[model samples]
Target chain A: GAGVSQSPSNKVTEKGKDVELRCDPISGHTALYWYRQRLGQGLEFLIYFQGNSAPDKSGLPSDRFSAERTGESVSTLTIQRTQQEDSAVYLCASSFGTGGTYEQYFGPGTRLTVT
Target chain B: SQQGEEDPQALSIQEGENATMNCSYKTSINNLQWYRQNSGRGLVHLILIRSNEREKHSGRLRVTLDTSKKSSSLLITASRAADTASYFCATRSISGGSNYKLTFGKGTLLTVNP
Candidate 1:
């Protein structure tokens, strides 16, 4: 892909339902990240994957939030028993590598509305 | 907790004017980056300033970093209506061990009138 791509641009789910968000990173990119942003709020770091190793998982808000990546390719974020507070935009980004200076390219994001 | 916070939550300006936004962060950082978002969509990278560098420019965009004060500012010269969007600043922590994550600020919403 020429750019980072996210699936199901918009999602409306009921409370307690499970939702899965997907991300397809740019070709040959080695680093992937997931973030959450509430309305009128800054982005919240969720998880980061570099190649096949993730050294940081401290940002995941709760046990209900979990994510996984396969190789250096696609990644998925799963939210179990979603709550009304879960209504927000989920963004995914990828960089050439996990280095500190690499700039991340973001996806269109998935707007999840929990009713 | 947000590592960075942008000032002036919202600003409205006419086209051709300059738009400036500031970001302040706690703790040291290896670099700072600015991004823009339109209509709640994904963010687009604008510019980045490393800790060793004081200022950088790209096209109509100017970015300045003050590591000593732990603050940064982004200046968009001759702004256009197309520049109407939200601007955010993100910082890379200076802990120095695979710190690839970027912590973002609340962002400033800029509206440029025609």
Candidate 2:
């Protein structure tokens, strides 16, 4: 649509349950990113997808955190076997390029709470 | 790990006063960008300064970069209550393996009193 959009806006799950956060990036944008922000903290890079290049999975904090983006459109970040530490605002952003002066457009973000 | 660190941690100023926040990074960067967040939700892109450039302005916001010192500063002139939010500086590193990643700082919480 006009800008990056994220689903749910808020998610509350059990400590052991799994949660999936979705992001629909602005059309034609070749790069998308997932980040997490704890209360009073900064954005932490979770994963990045750029064009057809191999998705940068290096930022994933653990094996339980995974993301999938089909081509350049929608992306889903799944947190399996969630813990209290997973509670945070999950943000999604889209950009023309991660480099070369492209500024990221962010979504409203999904505030995930694991109880 | 976060590459940039914002100073002052938190800042409070009356409306119409100027608010300045500083950020320092550990490595070289291709560009430095400032973003604003309200109520802890989405972030709005403020301004960006490239490595080759030193300063940039967007409306009431101004940013300066010093590649030699690996530092940058954001200035919000004649601030308003609506301008009260968390400001962050994100850097696109120049490293070969991680040039695409934008590392962010903890942010400076700005509170503009009315």
Candidate 3:
């Protein structure tokens, strides 16, 4: 019974560079989501994936933010042309299904610092 | 724009004391969930109360949802120092088209002094 896990606990990159954050959801989870949290701020929804259907990219701030999930397992969030405003903690979460009644389990997150 | 807003922003209490946090949302929701975050790490799901339920309890945690008022409250009794953390309320809108998106509030910082 493993929980959600994210890679590169911390990442430091230069402006204009691209960074990819990885997330490994719990086994058997069919839904995954990505969110961003700025310092002392609330979480901002980024994207969501349910099974193999079309991913919800409505929350993506810009065209630079993209995410892909292979089947129902891992997901990778990529941010292109990073800016100072992009510096924040990228959190990943997953649940048994795609709606209410299921609680989403979160990952430790990857702190990205754009210098 | 966040769907939910937590009141009091911060709270400080002595160990064994009870703590209460309130959250107010603007839109209709199918359910409301409370989560605890230690420092800035990952969030831990504390409780989930459906819109139809007025009150629910889990150990020392009690959650109440009032759909008529579009608000909810989380009460933690006999709090310990380890209970100090940021509490957030997330709302799952009634619209099912959004899929798994849960709008979160800014959260309340709770400090339990032992």
Ranking by lDDT: 3, 2, 1
lDDT against the true structure, each candidate: 0.92, 0.93, 0.94
Task: State the displacement of the C-alpha of residue B16, model 3, in Å, after optimal TM-score superposition.
Answer: 1.2
Give residue A1's error in model 1 in angstroms.
5.1
TM-score of each: 0.97, 0.97, 0.98
The candidates score, on chain A by TM-score, as follows 0.96, 0.97, 0.98
User: Candidate 1 on A16-98: residue-level lDDT in tens?
Assistant: 99999999999999988899999998899988888866536788989999999999989999999999999999999999986
Off by over 4 Å in 2: none
lDDT of 1 by residue, B6-70 (tens): 99999999999999999999988888999999988899999989999999999999999998899
Clashing pairs in 2: none
Worst window of 10 by summed lDDT in candidate 2 chain A: A95-104
Clashes of 2: 0
- For candidate 2, chain B by itself scores a TM value of 0.97
Error of 2 at A87 (Å): 0.4
Q: Quote the positional error of residue B103 for candidate 3 in Å.
A: 0.4
CAPRI band of model 2? high
Q: Which consecutive 10 residues in model 2 chain B have the weakest lDDT in total?
A: B93-102
Of 1 and 3, the candidate ranking higher by TM-score: 3
lDDT of 2 by residue, A9-106 (tens): 99999999999999999999999999999999999999999988899998898999999999989999999999999999999999987665888999
Judged by whole-model lDDT over C-alpha atoms, candidate 2 comes out at: 0.93
Error of 2 at B1 (Å): 0.6
Best by DockQ: 1
